[model samples]
Target: MASNTGNAFDFNLFKRLLKYTNPYKGTFYFVGVAAVLLSFFSVLRPYLLQVTIDDAIMPSDNEGLVFYVALMLGVLLLEVISQFLFIYYANWLGQEVVRDLRVNLFEHMLKFKMKYFDKSAVGRLVTRAVSDIETISSIFSQGLFMIISDLLKMLVVLGFMFYKSWQLTLLVLTVLPFIIYATRVFQKKMKVAFEDVRNQVADLNTFVQERITGMKIVQLFTREKAEYEKFKGINDKHRKAWVKTVWYNSIFFPIAEMSTSITIGLIVWFGGLRAIENDSLSLGVIIMFIELSQMLFRPLRQIADKFNTLQMGMVAANRVFGILDTRSFISDEGSREVGKLNGKIEFKDVHFSYVDDEEVLKGVSFKANPGETVAIVGATGAGKSTVINLLNRFYEIDSGQILVDDIDIKDVKLKSLRSQIAVVLQNVFLFADTIMSNITLDHPDITEEDVITAAKQIGIHEFINTLPNGYHYNVKERGVMLSSGQRQLISFLRAYVSNPSILVLDEATSSVDSYSEQLIQDATDKITEGRTSIVIAHRLATIKKADKIIVMDAGRIVEIGNHEQLLQQKDGYYKKLYEVQFMAEESLRS
Candidate 1:
């Protein structure tokens, strides 16, 4: 989609990209001056040779020859210095620009709404941030600045050729239209080919990243062969995309090489005939034409190759900019900073949906007074999780007001609001770090001692100490080094250490062993005290002591009461759910 929006060498996109160079303008100007010097030096060498051959060698003046040779050597030295500065500084400028761009892009993504991530693939975004940005760097290092230098050098060479002999210059001009036309066609074709290549690369990255992440599922289900076959198909497509660009290059370069050969042949034939007929042309002039022809035509041929790099960089820039332009972030328009809320939460007739025309929460309303423990119980797809998501403002409600302390949450700074609450999700995630690091998440205010204190309060400190290194044990990625119950315990410690006024436990004890469940239940009771807690669980027994229970069915609250009050309604959804879960528990015990 990003490639589809722009031309191969879109001037508008190009100018927009140049704005990033404003920070590195000093280096950019240095590269520009280098280009001009390189070009001037390129033409000076051939002209020096012409003067040396015609004047010094013909008249047998050794001093004149030595002086011109020294000038030529000095010219070469300056050209090499200019070239070194051009390459080194151009790359330096490019790296600085992309470094700034990558940082800005990542910070922008950090503010995007949760729904944006839900709809995007992790691997494609990774490609945009990493490889695609690396390609844009080539636009400066190998493509744009280098092409400018080449073209300037070619122009200077052409001027020197005409100054020596217009007849030979005219002959060289005869081959220009055909090669230029061929270059135009090759460039257009390569643009499309390069776009396809980029698309295939992103697809390949996505497939590989997803498969690697879900390798456990593949192996558990014995789907290795099937997944491998699918990967081969994707890989074949990637190969075909790249082969298309290679095919275009193979056809274009040979034609350019043959054209260069023919133009040189024409210049020699015309100049030699002039030298024989009237002695109007010297051997030196003829040799200068030969050198100048290469200087002029080689750049034209190299431009086609460099243009491909430019085109590819442009395609990548389009993708990177596409993400930068996304407007999916939650509007943090509220300047109100409620320092340490009293934890009074109310949802007033909330209506919401993750997708259009399919509401997940329908006019759902509830209130948890300060320091009250509220429980929401329902089957899967009953919009129970949506309620918590809305509470955190992860997704915006369609038409509703969620208020904390009688202040509409929309009017509160997002950081201020989220900081006052802590959530322990059903699927706990821990970074690849020590247990202490994961628990504190490197929050400056939450120290290692504070984490240990919280863990002891929640009854997990003994379990943590039993690990290989106590609180310093590395959990590996996603806490794979720990059991499901162990990870859940760590998450609990994480929330407790935050010292939040409002606590949310979404199925925190659902998938643990009986012993771990008891530990978690004990931990839960300890943490929930004197805090406004929202417990979402399928297990009916977990929330019996909650001050209020809200039972939901099909996006609506079907019942709201304490355990005894809800059981009194025999035909209610809550009563039926309680009986089923109680019966299952009894059967397990028997």
Candidate 2:
């Protein structure tokens, strides 16, 4: 996203966010109430200064001084107590808000259609979900709290100062507009700077994630030096952004300090002249002005800093709210009226694209019987993947009707719709948990037997047996602890565990060895015997055994037949693909 979505802060999004954290109203309200109490205690410092000058120092009465000193001490204790409450609540609220925001953002992201992920950059998503939300939490917790309490303290102090002497108070008040103007200007610049900072951070994060994931490739190709240089470039960009942010901070603080200092100097000069004349000005009034002037500085500094924080946080808020603002392309009416599917699928004249500039699947039409293996074969970017993606309602077709058992797939609730189907994509994602837990995805109250059953069926039980912990072995993030083939098999087992009515294997066996592939192929056939199965593959051997094959080129289906029929059409695209694969296999055999 943009700096500010639609140029308005979007209160509706803010309200919706509050709904999730509203369960913690006790903590939120306590922070607010504690802040007001802190403001009340802040007003007493000037009161103490006035009493010391009027009752003790001015008249030289040591007897009355002790009582005032004790009173000041008591107020100090109250201030301490209030400050404690403020700190505790603000910290608690900050961490809690961050937790809640992360949860909400992730939950919303998961609910989105696959097309949303396809369009989003992982780096940008991480920035908004993590650092951006952190900025917002800081603002909501401590920043928002301090702004209100300090503003109230400033107002109360101003009232007290004016009552002591309106003349000096007005002189002090003259600097108010300058502070406000400076804050406004500085805040605008800081917001823009921090936005760049966030982007640079995202660039750097992407570099790090890619480097770590591709460490093997970098090592094998001896490209570490080149990769390091590329990484340093982004890292340097991030450094410059952070440096600029510091400079903006440096300028705002001093300017604010100097303005308040000038106001204080003027007040002192006026107060001193009045006292020399021995006019109505008492020492108490002069001392009070001095103390109040200092008090004004604290809030002035706070307000200036707060404005800068608000600016930086606005970028974060906008990004977070932007995620919340996104309306998924495919929406269910929440009317979970559809029951189990009948396995019949129809794609009628579908036209689709990831972006409007180019279409991926164009005017594709097909039908699948209840229990048939329909294999799709195409060159990369020729719309083989797009066909299954449409079936899953990942992207809404520009124009088409995808009927599942006579009901438009879009009409079914997303959760209900997805739960009825299982997909094993080319890349598998395994969690950092026990193999059993990963198989069940930590489904609560699920027994180990449920996992063992799926494992045995997918032929991964033998592999799990070799591990020391067996079912208890932890699969590190993305299953890094397992070999590629093992991870693939475990993923297959996980899918089989779900027992979905419609099974989609998108190059499922492409990563497996021949022996494992055979075992999986046997399992696939046995399991999908009376269910709908769709396979997308480039390997001609795999699909040769499929009941039907659809040959596609450039988003359109050019031919369709059983294995033998496509071979008879010798001049077609399928024949060329078949010949290439056959030759490759023959060479391997030789």
Candidate 3:
């Protein structure tokens, strides 16, 4: 339905949408039954009008006219009641269907992996959750009902008119081709217009969210004017989409009105001539024809509106389904059991590339024994973090096998593997909630004592006590109320609460202030006691006490030794990195 663009409106979306109506079988049956009765009653009105005009009023028969008038009133009463019932059931079904659809969409979204989020914008998801569902609901509430009502009215009216006079019926229908021709032209253009507009609006929404979230950074850098101009450009694209949408709607609506109006004009022009020339057609029959004409054309116009709405909804469905169909890049069959691990890990012939164009980790291999601490140091993007990612199985390697306790990692269930290792990620994430709830993540069984014990281990117990509300204090969205170091401390506490066999810290103290850094380091040292910890760090001075330091460059391990042993390799990269940090430290002390 995309005009010269030649794209077809996805009819399958409508098919899927109707499945919701399957549950409302009683309502659907009622609509059909009421429609038949309503249409049956509609024909009676025209017949009663014909009798009243041609026989009762012409002969001035009062008793007969009164009885006919009573019949007409009763039919009117029945039609009104049926219409009310029809509208009620239609609305009830529409709302329930929309409710279930939104629930399914959100549930499916939760099943998607982290990569889906990396590729999709938040505003686009939000629009699908809200706007897209509403459009489909509108189709049910208005479109479905209108289609049923109008088509039924058309069938009843046409049958009656043709029975009364085929000549008049044919005359009325003669101009329908023009209406169809005009509607066909606009429907295709209008469908494309709405789809383009919806996509543009989604893009605009995405831009707004990105800029708003980064607004503080913009102000800090004094890039407000430049940001505004960038925003203005997106706004203009959205505006163009809107202009085409409104233009098609404006032109289509008036033209449809004129087309329907012309049919009525033709009926009046011809009907009046017939009545004057032959005195065969009655005034009541002409009036009935006029009423039926309006009912028929009205629903056709509504169909056009529904057509536009369906296009927008289908575009949204296409985007939503595209995500639903995307397979999680990292997943396990979860059928294999490796039992419990003894924390012995070895990476064999590992190779990986986030983008296929360039390798990040290539043919990397290392091993660590149980209860031993391994420190990883490298310049950024030197495959240091990549090693930890492999340990957690966040990404599947292209060609490699990682062994835990001499058992292959691929054979272990993801949950069984993950539960054993506690990760304190670099960018800590906290929900919008109270401190106690965030720490526990609403586990339902976690006690305040458990929270305190974890906080105590992380050296944050005193900090929480100093707050006015203690552990009950609000963390705000993403813990924005707290400093970066405080957030890191809480995340460390959360990881500690897990009490796992392996601890993976990704540059955990990089953002902490010197005083906070020392506290976090002390807490980290205590937590790593008698456990396996593979740590990634930027500041080389902190890892001096590490059992073994693995210096990595590009995608391979270049040196593996104790701090003093590595430093003696003056010709190596590790020694050069050490001297740079050592000089910075000496300058600070002086």
Prediction 1 global C-alpha lDDT: 0.90
Candidate with the larger lDDT of 1 and 2? 1
lDDT of each: 0.90, 0.78, 0.77
Structure candidate 1, residue pairs in collision: none
Off by over 4 Å in 2: 1-33, 174-177, 334-342, 444-446, 508-511, 538-541, 570-572, 586-590
In model 3, residue pairs whose N, Cα or C atoms come closer than 3 Å (at least 3 residues apart or on different chains), thus clashing, are: none
Tens-digit lDDT track of model 1 for 1-590: 33453345688778889999998788899999999999999888888999999999999999999999999999999989999999999999889989998998999999999999999999999999999999999999999998999999988888877787888998998998888899888888888888888899999999999999899999999999999999999999999999998999899899988989998889788888989999899988988888998888889988999999999999999889999988999989999998888999999999999999999999998999999989998888999899889889998889989999999999999999999989999999999999999988899998888888888888989999999999999999889999898898888889889989899988655568988888888888888899999999645456788999999989999999999999999798988988888558757767
Measured on C-alpha atoms, candidate 2 has an lDDT of: 0.78
State, as a TM-score between 0 and 1, how close model 1 is to the true structure: 0.97
Runs with alpha carbons beyond 4 Å of true place in candidate 3 = 1-8, 20-81, 337-340, 508-511, 539-542, 586-590
Better of 1 and 3 by lDDT: 1
* RMSD, candidate 2, Å: 3.2
